[model samples]
Target: MLHIWGRLSSINVRKVVWAAQEVGVAFERTDAGASFGVVNTPQYLQLNPNAMVPVLQDGALTLWESNTIVRYLCARYAPGRLYPEPLAERFNTERWMDWQQTALNPAGRHAFLQLIRTPVELRQPELIRQSNDETEHLLAILDAQLGQHAFVAGAQFSMADIPVACELHRWFGLPQARLPHRHIERWYQTLRERQASQGVLDLVLS
Candidate 1:
């Protein structure tokens, strides 16, 4: 059986867990990050030098990095389903994943930290405002893409949706100024209906 290390509340862990559910893989999870504390231990560090929340252990293979784990699971298990079959299609899916890492995540992290992680007394109003503005700017790009396609990769849902969808949960849950993208909201509503998405990505941001 596959062994996963991470706390259930972690978004990175949620990505891997969501992918596992989508691919129908049997796996066991052990809480390890934040309050769980297994991540800093010597044994866990040997498996993942970064001491990240999510580490995948299957047979002799060990993998870290949430997106990499998601890709590996999808390719090895569901191939051509969650993982795109064609080279061009696969790269296209990868593009959105990259976008999430480079663009959406930074914005989402800022907003999440300011809104949820930081207490009201200690929170910086300027940072919160900036984060909210940045989030809106990043979301506008997603809105445009979603307007044309039902999913990130055109019609069918793919591994591409996992990271972005997780971010979307935070974006929607936060008490922001306003969102101009109706299409993004509509797309998010669609994701909310998925069992795996609900089980993993749909959680209070912290």
Candidate 2:
């Protein structure tokens, strides 16, 4: 059995859980990180020196990094469905997965931390504005891509969609500036309908 360590509320952890569900993988999840507090334990640190949530243990294989875990799960279990069969198609999907970590996540983190995590009196208005602006720009890019295709990589939903979809919940849930991307909104609606997403991603932002 695969063992996952992370708190359910964590976005990184949620990505792994969502991916596991997408591939119909049966696994055990142990609460850790944030309020749950197992991430800092000596045992947990040995598994992931970075002390991050979502360390996956599958028999002899131990994996860190949430996106890497997603890829591994799909590759080992779901294969052609979640990982994609063709080399070109897999890379195309992989690009967006990397893009989430490189681009969307940084911007989303800034905005989410400013608006949700930080106290209003202590919040940095200038930084908040900059973060919001950058997120909007990134979402606009996604809006354009979503317009051309049904999912991020194309019509079929793959592991690539999991990370960004978690981020999208934050973007749409927060009481911030309204986005003008009809296609992206439509895509989000579709994700909302998923049984796994409904249980995992459908929650009030913390």
Residue 62 error, candidate 2, Å: 1.0
Candidate 1: tens digits of C-alpha lDDT, residues 1-206 = 99999987788898888888888889999988998898888999999999887999988999999889989999999898889889999999999998887888887687788777788898888887888889789888888999999998789999999888987876777766676688888888888888777677567766
- The predictions' CA RMSDs to the true structure, in order, are 1.2, 1.1
lDDT of 1: 0.86
In model 2, what lDDT does residue 71 have?
Answer: 95
Per-residue error for 27 in candidate 2, Å, reads 1.4
Off by over 4 Å in 2: none
What are the clash counts of all predictions, listed in order? Answer: 0, 0
Candidate 2 Cα lDDT to native: 0.87
Error of 2 at 161 (Å): 0.8
* Total backbone clashes of candidate 1, pairs 3 or more residues apart or in separate chains: 0
TM-scores for candidates 1 onward, in order: 0.95, 0.96
Candidate 1 residue runs with Cα over 4 Å from true position: none
- TM-score (C-alpha, index-matched) for candidate 1: 0.95
lDDT tens per residue, model 2, 119-170? 8898888887888888889999998999999999998888888998988887
lDDT of 1 at 84: 87
